[model samples]
Target: MTAHYKNIVVHLPNWLGDTMLALPFLHGLRSVFPDARITAAGRLWVSDILHHFPPLDAVASISSTSGLINYLRGEKFDLGFLLPNSFRTALAFKLGRVPERAGYALDMRGILLTHPLKLTDAIMRESMVEYYMRLLEPFADISEIPRIMKLYPDEADRAEARRVFLENGWDGSSKLVGVNPFAFQWDTKRWLPERFAEVADRLAERYGVRCVFSSVEKDRPLMEKIKGMCRRPIIDLVGKVPLKILPAFMEHLSLFITNDSGLMHVAAAADIPIVAVFGSTDWQRTAPWSQKATLIRRQQDHEPCMKPTCSRDFRCMNDISVDEVFNAAEKYL
Candidate 1:
């Protein structure tokens, strides 16, 4: 059977935030290849967020590299977009015999890609969304891009969100404010939980909004500590909501206040107003891509670097007070 450039595979970014940032690229790809069948392959947790993504005909979780390549060999994908810079990703496409593959020439994988793009240092400094969007330039004519991150939670997802809201006894009259206190995988990016507690307290007491704390199962201990510190009522949804259902859950929120974590991007994709607190991470590179977002970050002595752990006195995050976040939240609440 000869391939007709109909089956296309996109190797999605692994991180949740990066995955969310890739939506615009996927949208552009769909526009460019309207008749082509697009399959997004990634970890189950990462691609689960795109359960309602319209551009994708299917979402397949890649559990093993060899398994993926073997599967692709049979399917005969004509073109591939290797979004992840890992050499393994390019190798998979190369071995799978995807005739046309395009990606950044990083991780020494340029030889594997048929269309390897060399991004300049200046281009690397742009927002992750823009960086991802640039990848589609070779495949499509992208004139204008939408800044607002978008997610499509179906009617069933919306119904589930409403059910959870009712079960939590959330009053429809009162605005819902989401507080995510943990920043996964980076210690320097996390602001003090006490600060988040204070901000959640103020949102409830002063703004008259119902505050909900959202976090993954691993961050439960931190969530508990923040919950203990708070004086006002806070509904704990930690570890309960699945990633696929999170967009629906976020739909109930009027505003989301969070550390520069994956959920921050999720909130933005859900189109809820966000107050994202940045610490050591450069807001320019990874801030929530939403016009309604208010970024609260203290100025650093030096330009932000990609150091996961802070070498300096963690003043960048420590200096961002509860008042600043509360003030930002006031705009939406």
Candidate 2:
């Protein structure tokens, strides 16, 4: 029998990409408890991006453990879900006095959860979308989980995206290709700036499409480096576009070429055709969960390094040629 949950609180994932991947789980939760008031608690940025998402009734910006506990206590949540596999998060839920808690039994937090699901090696090998969907098994049929990830962009978001495009002189006559040259977590995951520049220029020359570059504030220097290397003029929107408006902005893109990064998932959710470059990270686990997406990674005799940082001179990324990436993008264009 399905448990009765009136006021449910879910601790969302910390990373933007993982948070996007959790859409299916959220969908499943809402399906099983249609009338429940579901609140998503996570970092401030996560709350900001998911503010307009329909599945969530409210978004709580969790700053510290004590603050999260206080907020959860004040809300009197009947049930809680921990998307992040951290002992601290489970402790917060327990101390917050949530009656029922469900999550994977990883990090030795099994005792804290009322429904502690096992985390298996097979589940670990599955795509992140599937991995997150597994969390719904106790409450609903896993097969019912939504395969397609989506983001709801409001009218203001669309207007902001339009304003950025117009200010950047995009006339909407030609196709716009987005190139993201930097990865947030790992330098090993990034393709060379020169290669990215070459691919951007080649795509422009071949398809008559304008290349638009994007990244966060900290990665602006890398975007600048790529822009300097490119022979063609590119629209650089690094640090200018807000996270909330990214999905709307990506909807205008014909194609997105990027590393296995947060924006790659955003583009995938936006339904943009993508060519994602993969390196040290496990591509199978985190590949864009979109049919329109194409992944490019070098074949290796050994397993992927799977490290945050690489010491092997980033051979996996370096081996993937600009021609290969351009050809992948060409198929979409």
Q: TM-score of every model?
A: 0.95, 0.97
- Model 2 residue runs over 4 Å out of place are none
Candidate 1, 1-333: lDDT as tens digits: 123569999999989989988877888777778888999999887988888888899988878899889978988889999889999999999999999899999999999988888989897789888888787777655666444467889998888777777677676667888888888788887888898899888878887888998778898988888878999988888887778888898988899998889899998888899999888788898988888999988776674756789878888888888788888889886
With candidate 2 superimposed using the best TM-score fit, by how many Å does residue 178's alpha carbon deviate from the native?
Answer: 0.6
Question: What is the clash count for each candidate, in the order shown?
Answer: 0, 0
Which 10 residues in a row give candidate 2 its minimum summed lDDT? 301-310
Clashing pairs in 2: none
Best by TM-score: 2
Q: Positional deviation of 119 in candidate 2, in angstroms?
A: 0.9
Q: Roughly what TM-score does model 2 have, to 2 decimal places?
A: 0.97
Best by lDDT: 2
User: Which clashing pairs does model 1 show?
Assistant: none
Each candidate's lDDT (Cα)? 0.85, 0.88
